[model samples]
Target: MSTAAEVSQNNNVGPVMRQGELAQAVVEAAEIDNPDKIIKVEDKVAYLRIQTSDEMILKRQTIEEMLGRPFSMSEIEIELASFAGRIDTQVEYIRFYHAKHL
Candidate 1:
């Protein structure tokens, strides 16, 4: 399989993850990519996303953690299908999705 760098080839080496999933992954990446990120855990679910200017960064594993399972083929398709129409650049998009489960 292609490595993270090969996938995010245009970027500075990273996995090929979705914008929404990337938002969640970067937040879950580690404590260092933080201070700007703040997760809001409500009910039985946890919402996460990044607070940086670059929304294209993908760190796939974070999404799996949030999802609790590898996303299904249809699930991935659905998220990407609606990806562009979502215009909220400033707010936490991934968290918005996560919050729904709460």
Candidate 2:
């Protein structure tokens, strides 16, 4: 487990979650994606910080698969303690990334 300070100091970007079933689901979804970007995970006693180089996405269907139950994207807001990138949510997925200007 990393201290809050250490997690914040990280230059990576992703979602932070409070400990619970939802947190577990997020981890599982990330593993399934296995993005090319470097991903870092830090577990704090009551919170978890999942970081990636630039972008990450977690789909509602994937979470449902991990949880063995139906899930709504809105549920993420309940466990989302914080985040370090731009967030885009749709009916099927949530994406975290730093936006690039045109």
The best candidate by TM-score is 2
Model 1 misplacement above 4 A: 1-52, 72-75, 82-102
lDDT of each: 0.33, 0.84
Clash pairs for candidate 1: 4-14
| Residue 35, candidate 2: C-alpha displacement in angstroms | 3.5
lDDT of candidate model 2 versus the reference: 0.84
Candidate 1 lowest-lDDT run of ten: 93-102
lDDT at position 75, candidate 2: 88
Question: What would the per-residue lDDT of candidate 1 be over residues 1-102, giving only the tens digit for each residue?
Answer: 898867543211122224554334444553232335443212212322222322332223444566567643234334332221122222122311211111
How many clashes does each candidate structure show, in the order listed?
1, 0
- Per-residue CA lDDT of model 2 for 1-102, tens digit only, reads 998867655446678999999998898898787556666789997999988866788899999999999899988999999997888989899988876521
Candidate 1 scores a C-alpha RMSD against the true structure in Å of: 15.7
Supply the TM-score for candidate 2. Answer: 0.82
TM-score, one value per model: 0.27, 0.82
